[model samples]
Target: MSDLTKLNSPELSQFSHILSHAVKVPGLIFLSGQTPTDSSGKVVEGGIKEHTAQCINNLGKVLDAAGSSWEKVVKVNVYLDDMKNFSLMNEVYEKLLPSPKPARTCIQAAYLPNGVDPVIVLNHPGQIGAGYAPVLDCHTAHIACKFAELLEKIDRRTNKSIEANPKTIKSGDSCIVKVVPSKPMCVESYNDYPPLGRFAVRDMRQTVAVGIIKSVEKTDKSSGKVTKSAEKAAKKK
Candidate 1:
């Protein structure tokens, strides 16, 4: 008989099809990377510190389901969207994982699973039909520049309360635009991770504008409700 068994937890049933939670052999067990999502599949609300805690909590569930414990964990691998969060993430890691911790490796990833926020910064003035004009319901491309190499197609955007709610943004206007990515992507605030912060606005093949991240709002993966929000001061020209 192959002394191998697959481990699972009822709390993680929603993610069962994605992959086995863990695998156990005679003397060792291998676990998949646990995200900061809850049992209901919603990303927990908070910063990296809170996120790190949730990941470990989820891992504990799988560990218990496998008849194992964190004390037996021999190795660990952490993938971070931004290395700048290392210190904050480490603070939580040190508190949760026991001493004489498992061998671990941490690396910055170009992008993660959730999604990114797109804020447009208009540099030049919008010309009537000559320059770029973004309407309320039009889809546009949000190209991540700097460190993150991602091209996310935005389905639509909401206008923030600025003077009057403008339906169409001209090329040179200064205002806040809220956009949702067509797909999930990893992104960080410009203040927190500058490399993942800068991006270019594209309409078809033309680059319309460029901007830095002012805020981030993450939606629930299952319910699609806004769960977390982070804001930063927009730079003055």
Candidate 2:
């Protein structure tokens, strides 16, 4: 198609004869799946975490060739050789992508090129559901018991300036907490919708802390604007 423009990265020139790193048309860019291969087309050495980073890094080159960036990516598809590596792969992924992360689908693949552990495809500038849900802030009202949890901590060395690790929190401690919903739900800021913003921290029959939602970060489905909402509700104290 004359209108379709193929985009190729000099760093990934080896793929030119077989495939374009990406294609562009008007307002959208479609990027091909990128593996952990380097410019020489050899799989990089490392574990799944390192492999995932390389895959996203390769995509970055294609995005640059297309005059686009990761922030402009609206959808992504991740292929993993094993579901067990999902968490390890996500460790690298969450750090690389920017706020309001793109909509993504990850599934296990029976096999991957070059025996790589992961492959990623990216699509730019379009609406796909509500986009990624990012926690704006979490304030702990109270802690009922001691537990270990993965919490986001400041890491100036990383691009995102934040990293997650399991930290032991003691009972009766007041600390910041992060909540991740298992599925996408319509959420509003506590300031905007009290009823929708309220939430409770519970584990089985034990109610930990009850508090109103301070804010939720999400991309509007239609306008694509990032919005925050708060909530007010009751919880067992």
- Scored by TM-score, the top model is 1
In model 1, which regions exceed 4 Å deviation?
Answer: 116-237
Question: What is the clash count of model 1?
Answer: 4
Best by lDDT: 1
* Residues 118-168 of candidate 1: C-alpha lDDT, one tens digit per residue: 344434344212122332111233323211111222222222334433344
Runs of candidate 2 with Cα error greater than 4 angstroms are 116-237
Candidate 2: Cα lDDT at 175 = 27
Q: What lDDT score is found at residue 184 in candidate 2?
A: 42
Candidate 2 residues 1-237, lDDT tens each? Answer: 789999888887354533788889988999999978777655678999999999999999999989989988999999997899999999999999888899999988655555311111112122211222222222322222211232333321221314344252233222233444543455544444434444444443433444445456575667844333332121111
